[model samples]
Target: MSTGPNRIMDEFAKLMTDAAGAAQGVRKEMETAFHSQAERWLNSMDLVKREEFEAVREMAIKARDENDALLRRIEALEAKLAEKGA
Candidate 1:
């Protein structure tokens, strides 16, 4: 009688362990599927990566700064020319 109860308990513990392992596998599969779908959706929208967007933004800022510097130089040259003429 004692051995019979121990055998039942052992089987129950094994069943619980198997169930927990199966749950983990299912969870991983779900996460992988969700990530794949999200990537596909983002690709369809033609979105740029964070690094690429930042690079383009930096380029634009640099170009604007260069333009402002050139404008200032041109104005200074014009003022000097006017002074010479006067």
Candidate 2:
């Protein structure tokens, strides 16, 4: 191969490599900025964390279960009272 063609090809390869490196750097910077902006936006809103939400959900479920049990117990007691009165 002629030196001229080889030199041109090497220069083209180096340019492509440099461009790829620059693109990667830009991509990383964009990702970091996007994440920062997203974090700021999220912080601006009032939101519950997953753990807190799950805790409240569990408390509600437990309260509902207890209420159901109490209701059933009352019904049973009422039935027993009627049987004795009759």
Q: What overall lDDT goes with each candidate model?
A: 0.98, 0.95
User: Candidate 2 overall Cα lDDT vs. reference?
Assistant: 0.95
Report the C-alpha lDDT of model 2 over 1-86, residue by residue, as the tens digit: 54798989998999999999999999999999999998888878977779999999999999999999999999999999999999
The top-ranked prediction according to lDDT is 1
Give the true-structure RMSD of model 2: 2.7
Q: Write the per-residue lDDT of candidate 1 for residues 2-86, one digit (tens) a residue.
A: 4788989988999999999999999999999999999999999999999999999999999999999999999999999999999
Model 1 gets an lDDT of 0.98
TM-score for candidate 2 = 0.72
In model 2, the clashing pairs are none
TM-score of each: 0.88, 0.72
CA shift at 11, candidate 2, in angstroms? 1.7
